[model samples]
Target: MIQRFLAPHRTVAAGMLGRLARRAAVCALAFGIAGAHAQETSSIVIKGKDGWLFPGWGSLTQVDVRGIDNTTRLIGQARDLLAARGIKLEVLLLPDKTLFYEDRLPDGQTLSPEVKARYGLILCKLGQAGISTFDDAAVLRQLKASGQEVFYRTDQHWTQASADATAEAMARMIGRDVAKLDGRPGTGMTLGPLFNERRYGDLAELFLTADEKKQVGREVYSVRRQAESSNLVDDAPAPVHVTGHSMVQPYFGFPQKLSSLIGRPVSVNWNPGNVGPWIVLLEYVESPAFRQQRPQVLVWQMFEPTFAQGPDASGLWDNASIMSANAWLDRLKTALSH
Candidate 1:
């Protein structure tokens, strides 16, 4: 029964998995024998090829299928509840950086078959549960294939180019579902000129020692400034609300790009650190912002690797952010009730 349901969305081919395993074995052997130089400075930071650093928290081998199903079921329930209040919920599930830069993984490190199939499996489950989502993996892959760097080599956050691309794609999807949004004319944000800046990545700053950081070096990033003349504040309540981690923050230009492309005012709330998506959502719905005027659409963004983790992932999520799944849902229900 499960196979039948997932057949249509199964993206990983058995042959591909076999090829990946063979390639990984050869790379492991080569790196093990010849390249003895330490690539990682810290256990939590993975040093990838060509100065690319990835967070070690995301596993390249583990895929908790049951956890994914439970997460999706909860998301579906949230969707139904939001629908009752005339709000459309769209989940923006961002794929891990490892997916796009598999070749960059240090010598022997490669994604396991389960990790390769994880994104597709979650998407299938979300679909089955009647939750709205888009294939962000496909969008990022296309952006990478086009020679644009989707993510920074040194930073955990994505590049502005990728953010713009994803925002455009998301806008199109939102347009299809919502014919028009509630906002006055000329309320949308205006994007400013793009500028280049060089800096050390968050990973390099947080985990790497002084010597290790020098070795990794700084990377040039393209950033977009908001127009100086643009007035973002308006009396009309924003019809679209975004809730997510630092990835969707204004610094990355995701929410700004989304507002420009969608031509609607987009209100956003985000927290840095591993606060987890569950708590982030609760924080938003319970805030005075949600009570002032409920948005017509709510975009909930989350990382794909951590998607399977429930709200009560004690050690995985930050100490204060952790809670049982039922407890999280109960809070959500209470917040939305008013």
Candidate 2:
């Protein structure tokens, strides 16, 4: 009797069940596609504790200091390699922005107690290895505390003030008094800027979405030289050579300020940001310019986060062009022999 009663609706029941299953499959596929897209865009930017935005990779959450030992060894070996050729290698590690602005990090985000001390750790290691270095983090902090913006609010680069301070500190480390170096009083070299131009920062363009880019805005003040400027003059190859990423580029004023502070011209070679210091260093050493005019001092500037990262992390250098840290040290030794 039950079969007879239910048999009438069985066909309808089966069709309904089939439709439900198909709908569920469609929903699952849609969600899968959405999830993939979300993962891809999740790294664009992160919200900081105080409404500040930061690059996801540059966040303290992604930091891995376990590679510190390998990094230390690489620095020591590189120092030795350069020393054999009578060239002093000075390493300048720029601290990550997240370290100094921890108070602005996201609410749930927390730094390991040791994270704050990482800069000191690197300095200690470099010092033990007998490599010349400037206490960049300390200097930047002091500058910041004194009301000077050492770093841009929306960009990762150091401000001109910070660059000036570092240049002075570096000069002291090399035993070059800026006063004595600037022996020519009438040469017209001066740090006074003709004007300041406001422009969008790189991070404001890169990490922010189109809407966020328009809503959350930040600009950098670029100090430019005027047409009447006679302070800068053409000079021969400088005794001090600088190689690094965009931080040391001519446009950033790091090289120029450093030159003025050190009281001598300096040859700088760098590429677009994110090329990694390893490739930049290798290319500079192998360049015809370096062979023609070997510098007495080589200032190697790099960000602290990428110091331990292998060549693969750069994604800018081809495999054949880059090698492991140990292999790079060997190649450096051979290159300097000439």
Backbone clashes, each candidate: 0, 3
Best by lDDT: 1
Candidate 1, 175-229: lDDT as tens digits: 8888777776456677889999999999999999999999999999888876876
Across 216-314, the per-residue lDDT of candidate 2 in tens digits comes to 565757664533443334444466778887776655566666555555556777765456677677777777677887877788887775565655453
Span of 10 residues, lowest total lDDT, candidate 2: 1-10
Alpha-carbon RMSD, each predicted model: 10.9, 21.8
Best by TM-score: 1
Please give the distance, in angstroms, between residue 118's alpha carbon in candidate 2 and its true position after superposition.
1.1
* Candidate 1 CA-lDDT value: 0.77
Candidate 2 yields a Cα-based lDDT of 0.60
